[model samples]
Target: MRLSDISIKNPVFAWMLMFGLMIFGLISFSRMGVSQMPDVDFPTVTVSVSLDGAAPEVMETQVVDPIESSLMTVEGIESIKSSSKTGSASITVEFDLDRNIDLAVQDVQAKISGIQRMLPDDVDPPSISKTNPDDQPILWLALTYDKEDPEFLMRYARDYLKDRFTTVEGVGDIFLGGYTDPVMRVHVRPKDLLRYNISVNDVVDAIRNEHSELPGGYIQTDKKTFNVRTMGEAKTEEEFRNIVISRRAGVTVADPTNMVKIRQVADASMGLDKIERMSRFNGKTALGLGIRKQRGTNAVSVARAVKEQITVIQKTLPPGMNLQVNFDSTKFIEQSVGELNHHLILAVIFTSLVCWMFLGSWSATFNVLLSIPTSLLGAFIGLYFLGYTLNTFTLLGLTLAIGIVVDDAIMVLENIFRYNENGRGRIESAILGAREISFAAMAATAAVIAIFLPVAFMKGIIGKFFMQFGVTISIAVFLSLVESLTITPMRCAGFVHHGERKTKLGKGFEALMENTRIGYDRWLRVSLQHPWKVLIGSLVFVAVSFISIKFLNKEMSPAQDQSIFMARLIMPVGTSLQYTDQQTKKRKRGSCPVRKSNRCMQPWGALVAVFLIPT
Candidate 1:
């Protein structure tokens, strides 16, 4: 028998196929991991150089110009934008979207290595950064303690807290920002630098050479092949101080005293000099912690894990030091998705009521209701396979398509009812309905899928989030079409009521349909006689379309503003605690940061009160 004939012959098998699709969908969805967004990478990178004391002009001449010139020959480069600031140079390298970002980074490394010797030896190795939404911090925490030196707090944040946070599954990068790591800094004196006549290069070479680590060549003499190695990792301040500088050329052939200790020559340059205190939380001394999540892990899950870990770690903190929660993206996702899910459930119930009222028979209504879950389950299965989510957009798309998805079931049932009312057999009515409207149902499904074609073609950020919604709904509507043609008819074989005298519920619907028909006929008759008026109305609508296009503001994605807020901090070279506290306390209500220093922190910017802070 043909598929439709087989479907008409067996309702149980049809339902089985539907559940099979559902099971497959659930499996696929489980396999797909959660992510902030899909795995589509942009072809862009940022390179930053820390020339701490150099002016913009000096960085431009010494750092930026050489790097840009060397990297100019990279493949697939679309454009280059560079900036030089008070203490650094930043060059943003943009490439074609189709290019591989990893390969581009590799190319940049090669380019830099080729010109390394030509650039200022004082400059640090340029760091490469990839541009991705995933790079955005998933969470920010502020740590504060009572009158403690910032170094101690930073050490706790790093040596104590950092390793634990990094070990959490799904965490990407943990950064200890807004403070120093508390290290002993050996300040090099200017007088010693001049006396030794040490160029910064000499100091750089001496330190690197003395601190060099080497793997040894093993010696084997039969009894045992023992390993041999020499190691060095800055044992003490004195070790760093006593490192030897090269012998100077003797003014006299036999003169023997020109060697210098690295400490003597290095004393001229100001080094990390006892970890300068940096302020976090708006000029109040604090240590800051940031967590970045790994891709493909659910944001909701990762955020919860981070919170739990923080709670566990809080018990270990010293008295007075506390952790302040600053950012949590998962909270927003959970709340928004929960609301969307509630609305979707309501939509499903309302749709089922519509089907039951129109059919006015328990058995017939059951077929249509079954079609709804079969369609929905099938759609989600498709979503799982496609690596999509039960997100706001996808749920909204499914909700919108609900009316369309049921249209097939309605058409099939309408035909079955019509055939049965003519005194046809139940078996004959089922087969006839399937045969009669199958082509029309398929055409309608095709049209719905066509509507989403443009959405799939959308490119860049906005497109990435939306295309899945469109595809999920389109697939669902199509599957419902298949059910309407095959399964609905088979289920109809055992049940289609036929009688001239109408049941009480059917009679009410019949009367309503008559009223709707009469009202629509009235409008149809007037429009048929006045084509010119209809044409003029079309012209007016077309004109309004142009006006809307010109007046509307545009954005790359839908604006999702939240009542949730955040705060940023700035500390001038020497902002005091009492002053910072006063400034935080004096914030004007509902404000944000402004250029004026006298203006207190914004109302949204919490003063980071010491007592209530959470670890």
Candidate 2:
């Protein structure tokens, strides 16, 4: 059967089909994930190894060189870069964009395992990880306190709050910054060690041996056997200090009739780990918790979840402590998405009003306007199935598609109205009008598709960003074409005016259009009479536009108002972590109002690798 014949004769079936599409579209849209940007897999992997007390040069030769050599043989490797720092080495391998990341990671793991025997015995096992851009921190939280020391706060967060944040849905990792645990630092002077006839190595061995748990052989009895467990770990700093190093029986003039202990040879005291890193907020000694979301998860949702959990976490915090969120990545996403939605609604309303004013009948306007929602709703289904997220680019495409989608519907409806006014029956005019414009409408839609479909085939990050946009617009246009041929004619056959039914509003609009037509006719006649003058005027206009192009400023993308700001501190090489923290504190204090009485953090030896200062 003919397309229009089927739609007009069986209007109920057509309506039912449309209703099904609407239902599916709504369901798909509701179920789709929301994020700040589309999910992109960065093609990079990292291998890091740590060897204590090794110089940078030693790290390069023993750790980085071995790993880089092995990774070079992996398939699809694009490039390799390595960095050797004090006692540590990091090697990053970049692979082809189209390569399977899991397979690449597996290949790296295999390569590392083969070179295990070649690596230094004291070096820790090499770690292989795939780096994702999306894994960057989505939220920065600060836990500031006045009365408590920073070391206490750091331990509190590590012991109590770290696991709490981890339990939140979509939270991948939580990094604690600018805080370190109080580790015992034993200062053994050379005179004390010599007097006791003990070496620093002997003291180290004693401390290491003092803290351990080992399983002993099972004790067998007549009835049952019990497993033997020995716990020798120190529970307090005094207990650790009292650990014995060596016993002397007054056999020599330098040795006394006493056991040389850790407390005698080395003064054991609680102190922070040697500060390697420090974070500060607004000039206050601060501890930061950076929250990252898991891959493929919604960043906005995950960030929201973290914020809500923070509220709960605060209730349990110490009285003087406060947790404040300084940076949230989703604020821009929410604002941009909301603004786009507002513009989308406004466009639909204005476009519908334009259709009504031009058609001079509410029913004819409805016939054309129905295509907008139908096309957009159907496009959501396509987006969901194609794994496209609702991002700024995709929404922009939908907004631009609004004009294109309505064109075919208007064309079909106008043709049907023209035939109906020319003494044709409503049903016959609807079917015949739609049939007459079917090929034209198809060709026009194809032309629009042609303009954007090529973008989908382009390569690299730019291409990936626009691929969803092009596909989104193309799908909406195609759906609109189908809607115009089917639903537009079916509705027009029933609701469109079949005779010259005129109202005051209709008569006024008709008179206005008639005047416009006359004015255009006169202008056309004048142009035809003075073709040379018209040609010169057109040439002048073209020249002006061409000249204006050079003055326009261009940018790849507009800057977004993210409601967050960052401060970066570039310190000199070999600077102590303590010095970095001190500098950071001074800068932080100047940026925000801080309570002087509050020692936001205690001086601890904990070292931070990279710190984030949020304002």
Candidate 3:
């Protein structure tokens, strides 16, 4: 017996199965992550090494060359690119699409380890990390202080704010920008160094030796042993100044010696570390707290949690300090998903109206509409199990499937309705009608699945991006076939009746469709009579379509009005951070007229600037 026959005979079985699927799908939908785009892991890794004050030429030869040579030995490598800059070198290795990124990273690490001993001794250890979209910050906060204490805001963020934000669920890491730790600065006089006949390295060694606490050997007495530690670290600027660099004898052979201390050759004070970059909000110096979310987590959910945590954190902030959100990356994701949802609902509504118009019976139209939600919701089960997010591509697939998913149900419903019109009982017509068309419905669904299934398994980066789209449509189509053979048939048998009443609008729509059918038939007969002319015309139209392609604008994606845009300023390579800040300030002032205009404004109207200094 066919599945439709079983469903018709045992109505309770069909109803329970339908309800069970819907329940499971709803649960899966609730648990699935939401994002702007599908999560794809690129087969790329980066290795960064830094050596303080190393010249670009030195870094390229000593650091970048060795690392690239090592990474070349890793399997499945597509390309290796290196950038050597003052004091730092970065190497990016891209692997083939078939390569597993985790294994590739391990191989790369092993290769680098093999060459580590050959690299320069002073170079820092190589930092290795895989490329991930989630590494980008999802939220940015601007912290400002009313007082002139530059160190206070950074200390508060490091000691308190960072810990608090990290406690929020799904937060991966917190990064601070435009802030530096306080350190003792030693400004050595070049003339004094020459007079003392001491090199800068001598003073550096003296400070490095004196400003560290070292472990001493344990002191053992008769009855007990004690762990001894040397207290050599300086706690105050004066202590650092008192450090002795060298001692020299006087002019006379037997004269007493002269001691040269750090105070004589250098001035020491507490100040910020090197300022390489800065962030500003509304033209005021501010510290930026960028929050990155963990992988495989919902961006919207994480942002919501961070906002809620921010409310709790506000109470603990100091009186003269303030924190405000400067930029939120999740807002675009939320808005895009919301818009897709709106379009999905409209597609369903319009599709239902079209079905009602053609079927001319509200009861039959209702059976067809029931297939849409069941098929779409059931697709969530596949997506959840496949680790797919509710992103643009998946949601777009569902939206497009709104029209396709109704095909199977419409075929079965129309056939069953024809049987009922032939003086047969509803239940008997449904069973006979569905069994007759079940093979044809399955064939049609198979054709669609065959077309899309290959798309899901396509190779390369483009395939990864569109795999969700293909699989989503295929799942929805498959589920629709299942519903048509089971729930759809069952519902039709119970609800649809022969010669059911129709409204005037439905009657008018049916009349219009009948006229259209007659017109189409007349044209079809004419075309059959002049097959040669019709074929030539079709060829001409196809040719025109191909010719028009060159005139069309092409892009990866259409431009959208996201209510935000960014402008970048690149200065000369030798420009300083202070100069970059000044130039950005001038540009910000020049845009005041646009900011004041009511036509072009955003909710966060202030212009946020980031200053960068070349290495």
Candidate 4:
């Protein structure tokens, strides 16, 4: 039997099929991952090596060159880019889109391992890591304290906060921003070192040699053998300070314990490792905790879980310390998706109203409107099966689909209503009406799909982004065509009333339609009679359109509101922490930096602009 016949006779099957699609679509939506963009495999790996006190030239020649040369032989390598900064070398290896990033990283690690012995003894082993778009921080949290020292904040975050955040689901890693591991600082006065006749190397040797512990070998006995442990590990600043440096031999009647200690020659204290990086929020000393989500996870769900956990964690924080969310990625995605959904709903309502006004029948409008949800709901099934996420691109496709999906249903129902108005029976009119436009509907759907199919299969990054959009629109359109052929006719046969009941709105609509038809016919006759004048006017309109194209500014993509802002302060050369703090506090909008000598005179200006800081 024909599809429409089956749909009308076995309407139960059609209803059940539509219901099944709705159920599966809802389930798929709930299970689908939410992200800012499609999870495209970046296929990039970075190898970084640090050699302290080495110049950029030395790093390039010694560290970066060898790694790049070795990695050039790896499979699927597209390009290799390297940069040599002061005392460090960074090499990024990009692979073809089809390359497995995990295997590529393994190959890099193996290459590094083979070349480790060739590198300098002081240079650290290369750090190999696979980079993904998911590596972008999902959240930026700033932890600030009013009266606590940096050491205290660092210790607290390292000991308590870092581990807790790592345990949160979907969190791949928690990087403590502006954090420094502790180190013992030895401040040696030049005068003191000269007086003691000791050099920096001598002091280093004293600490390194005396502060270590080694196994003292087992002492054997007849009854039992005991393990002997040496106990020279320095556990305190005072202990480190007391380490012996040198002893002077003098021929005199004096006490034998006359060796010079490290503290006597040089001051010893605990401090953070040489300050390489610092974090601040509005000029105030702050620690940022960047939480990154795992690949293929729902960013909205993960961010919500993190926020909820942070609420529970706040009660346990020490007084005067506060944790605030600086940036949340989901806020933007949720807002964009919500706005699109709102527009989608509005489009459906407006489209329904237009259908009612034009068709002048509530049943016809209802039948036309039914296709919107059925087709969109069915698109979710395709997305779920294709491993696509509910991201901005996919949502955009759905938004555009809102305008196209209803056309098929509108065509089918309008034809059916017209046939019924001609005195045909309900079932006969529904079936014949749908059958007449079946080819037209199919052709229209295929033409639209053909236009977007090329975009869906585009090559490179742009293609990856637009693929979901194209696929989503095509799926919705195709399903609407199906619904138009089957469900639309079946519904029309059952629900469409035999005769139109007269109403004031209906009369007004008929009057408007009559006026529109008259104006169109008059315009067509005028155009046919004065063909030369119509051609001239058309040429002028076309010329203006082409001329307008030059004035229109274009960009690759429009900027989306991410619901976050950032500001950067550039300090002058040799600017002291105190001077920087004093200048920063001069601005009414900025907070104070963590420093004691905060009183100084310097004018500073911060241009309010967005800057994407390199990670």
Candidate 5:
């Protein structure tokens, strides 16, 4: 049978089948994770290593150089850069865009480990950290309290907060900074070391030996084992002072005649000391919390997890202490996504209403609505496959698409109705109407998709962010056109029936369209007869539009909706006393009066030479 014969025979069954397809399409969309922007990962990796007794130059030569040089031989490694600071070395390796990070890291590790014995003894093994900046902290918080001490905050964060939310499925890690415990410091004077003929190494050994408590060898007297130990260790500074260094019997190293005593050379003490200052928030001493999301994880989901954990821990915080969020990507993502979603729904609803009004049949409306869900689902499926996202570009394209997708449906349905009015049977009209314009719809969709191809080819950061959107919408619109030509025609053919009747509203709509065409005919006739007037009027309109663009203040999208709006006026535009009086009257109602509070702003205040901020 011909394609037309199939559509004419069973259009409603075809409609039902398409509905089932839409349900499957919904399943495809559900598998997608939500994010604010296009999902992509840069190809980069970092090696972190610690070096003891090394300055920056020494660290660069001893640790950073060896690692970077070794990794340089790894295949597909693009660029290798290293930073050597006080006691640590970080070497970042960037790879080509197509390189797999996991494989690259494995290759680097295998090569470095094979040459392990060659590295210095004091250099700890280098750790390959995943280099995606998307996995970096998406949220930052400042925790502050008056009564809580640094030790208390430090203990609370470590014991209760950091691990709880960080363990959430998509959360990478949570870091707490600013507050640290005072560490135990053992400072020994250099004079004491010389006085006792003891070196710094000896003092270090003494401290290490005195602080530890360990079990010694067991004794086997009477078949009952007993453990022995050397007990005179320092529990406090006083105890360390009395820790005997040399015996009165002249127990000497290398058989020396010098006798040693505990007080002969050095003063040693155990006390707590602060080593490094930490970062503070807003000029106030407070602990900062940073939350990182796992790679390929949902930003919004991890943020929600952090909040839930914070809620549970809020009860345990010291009085007046709280975690205040300073930065949250989720806020902007949720807002922007929510607005786009709202617009999508409104567009769909408005389009559906318009379609129903024009068709005046419930069955026709239902069939048109079927394409809405299917188009969106198919778009998401394409996105999932291609790694695109529902970001600004994709959404804007979808918004632009609200009118295009339904054009085929409207045209096909209208033609079908037109055939029905010609006294042909329902099945015959369905077949003829669908066959007539399927090619035209396909061509228009091709044009739409073609417009975005150049957008996909755009370069740099801006291009990277918007390319996913461009490709997603491009593919979606093309698929929609195909579906409209193929699936839509098949369904419309089968659903049309012998007994179907046109509503009065549809007939009226047809009459209005007829009247509009007649009006256009008259306007064209008048314009063609007066070419000079037409040319002059068009020129005037163009000039006015140019002037508007030059003078008016415009923004790309709508600002937040509110009951009030404000305008700031500077040394600008011509006005009259009547306009100024009107503006003053308006300000008296709802606007706050602007105050110039700086004494320097006064003309007679000696005009002090001060640069508050360099111009």
Candidate 6:
């Protein structure tokens, strides 16, 4: 027996099955991650190495060259690019799309390890990480303090707020921008060094030797053992200045007159660490807290959790300190998803209205509309199991599927209604009509699946991006086919009535459809009489469409208004940070007259400044 025949015989079974699917789909949807785009792991890895005081030329030859050469032997590498900059080197390797990112990372790491010993000894260990676009920060916050001490914000962020934010669920990492630690700096006078005939290394060795705590041997007694330690680290600027560097040969231990001390040659004081980068919010110096979410997590959920945590943190903050949001990336995602949802609902409503106008029966329209939700909701189950997110691509697929999913239902309903109009009972007509149209419905569904299924398995980066889109539409269509054969037939047999009362609007729609049918028949007869002319016209239309393709605008995605604008400023090579900051300020002043608007200007040591203007 056909599935539809079984569902009609046992109507209870069909209802239970529909309810079960709806329940499971809802549960799966609640657990699925939400983001702006599909989660695609790019087959790329980056290796970064650092060496203190190393020039770009030295880093290129010693670090980047050796690393790139070693990585060349790794399998599936599409391309390799390297950048050598002051004190650092970076290498990026992109693998074939079919390559697994995890396996590729391991292969790259093995190659780097093999060449580690051959590289310069002073080069720091290379850090390796996979490339993922979703790994970027989802939210940014600016911290400001009214206190005069510049180091207070950095210290607070490092010691307290960072740890607190790290504990939040879904938070992967917390990065502090424009952060500098406190350190004791020693400035040596070149004249004093020449007079004493002492090299710069001598003073460095003296401080390294004295500014440390050393382990002392234990003194064991008869019944107890005591551990001891020597505390020799300098606790103040004066103590660091007093550290002895050298002494004359004839100097006595009790007399310090012949001793050469740090105070005599250098000035020591506590100050901020070397400033390589700076961050400002609304033209005020501030520390930025950038929060990154873990892989495969929901961006919206993570942002919500962080905001709730911020609310709690506000109560515990000290006086004269303020925390404000600088930028949020999830706001756009939420709004876009919300808009797509609205579109999806409208599509369903319009599709049902069209079906009602043609069918001219409320019961038939109701049965057809049932299939739309049943198919869409059931698709969520498949998406969840496939590890897909409800992102733009998948949601767009669902929206487009709204039109296609109703095809099977409309075919079955129209056939069953025709049988009933021929004087057969509803139950007998439904069974025979559904059975007759079953093979045709399956064939139509198969045609659509054939077109989209290949897209899901396409080989390339583009395939990866659209895989979810194709699979989502295929799942919705397949589910609709099942519903048409099962629930749709069962409902038509039991609930759908023949010769139901029609309103005036429904009568008018029926008249309009009859006129359209008459017009179509007249055109069909005319075309049959002039087959040669019809063929030529159709050929001309196809040729025109093909020629017009060149005039169409093609792009990966359409431009969107994100409510923010950014400008990048690049200075000449070797420009100092101070000069870059000055230039950025000049550009900021010249570009916009509204000083009260929120602005974020970040300048790094490479003489690059990024200015963000939020609308």
Which one wins on lDDT? Answer: 6
Q: Evaluated with TM-score, which candidate comes out highest?
A: 6
Cα distance off (Å), candidate 1, residue 160:
3.9
Local distance difference test, each candidate: 0.71, 0.80, 0.83, 0.80, 0.65, 0.87
Q: Mind giving the per-residue lDDT tens digits that candidate 6 earns over 1-615?
A: 999999999999999888877889889888888888787888889999999889999999988998899999999999999998898888999998888899999998899899999988888999999877678889998887777466777888899999999999999999887789988889999999888766688888778878888888899999999999887899889999999885333232355565688988899988888788887776667788999998778889999999998888888888877787788889999999999999999998999889877777778888889888889989999999998988999999999999999999999988998899999988899899999999999999999999987888988777887899999999999999999999998999999976644688978877888899999999999999999999999999999999999999998678999878787888898999888888877887765444555656453555788877665
User: Residue 489 in candidate 3 has what lDDT?
Assistant: 89
Q: Which ten residues in a row have the lowest lDDT in candidate 2?
A: 597-606
TM-score order, best first, reads 6, 3, 2, 4, 1, 5
For model 5, what is the error of residue 145's alpha carbon versus the real structure, in angstroms, after optimal superposition?
A: 4.5
Clashing residue pairs in candidate 5 are: 10-494, 11-494, 11-495, 12-495, 192-265, 196-265
- lDDT, candidate 1, at 192: 80
Per-model TM-score versus the true fold: 0.81, 0.84, 0.90, 0.82, 0.66, 0.91
Over 208-271, each residue of candidate 5 has an lDDT whose tens digit, in order, gives: 6655777787888886998888674666666666554442223335444554434455655433
Model 2 stretches with alpha carbons more than 4 Å out: 179-182, 215-225, 246-259, 498-556, 581-590, 593-615
User: Candidate 2 lDDT, tens digit per residue, 1-615?
Assistant: 668779999999778767777889898888676666777666889999999889999999888888888788999999999998887888989998778888999999999999989999999998888865567788878887777586787788899888999999989999886667778888998998888687877777777766676667799999999998786788788988888775333232244456677878778777787665555544456787889887657677888888899889889888888888866777777778888899999999999988887877788877777888889999999999888878887899999998889999998988988998888988999989988999999999999999988888777767767888899999999999988888888898887874343788778878889999999999999999999999999999999999999999977577765533344566677667667667656655654344332223322223333333222
Error in Å for residue 459 of model 6: 2.9
Ten contiguous residues with the weakest lDDT in model 3: 598-607
Q: Give lDDT tens digits, candidate 1, residues 1-615.
A: 456678877778876887786777567656555543555556788889877678889999988999999889999999999999656789999998667899999998898788878888788888887887766777777777876656577667777888988999889888766555445454566788788776666666666666677787798997989888777646777777777766333222233366677777554232333332344454355666788887656667778888999899889889887776655666666777677668768877887777767776667767777777778777877777666655566767777877778888888888888888888888898888778888888888888889885686677556766777678778889889888877788778866564442677678887998899999999999999999999999999999999899889897556776544435445464456456556655542333243342212121112232221111
lDDT of 4 by residue, 1-615 (tens): 668779988899889877887889888888788887888766788888999879989998888888888888899999999998777889999899777788888898999999888888999877888766767888888888888588888888999998988889888889776688887898988888788677788787777767899779999989999999898888999999988875332222145475678888888888887665555554456787889988777888899989988998899999988887866777877887788889888988998888888777787787888888899998999998898988888988998998899988888887888899899999999888988988899999999899977788887767878999999999999999999889989999998874564888888888988999999999999899999999999999999999999999987578765533334567655466565555555542442232332311122223121222211
Clashes of each: 9, 14, 0, 0, 6, 0
Rank order (by lDDT, best first): 6, 3, 4, 2, 1, 5
Model 4 residue 587 CA deviation (Å) reads 4.8
lDDT of residue 585 for candidate 1 = 51
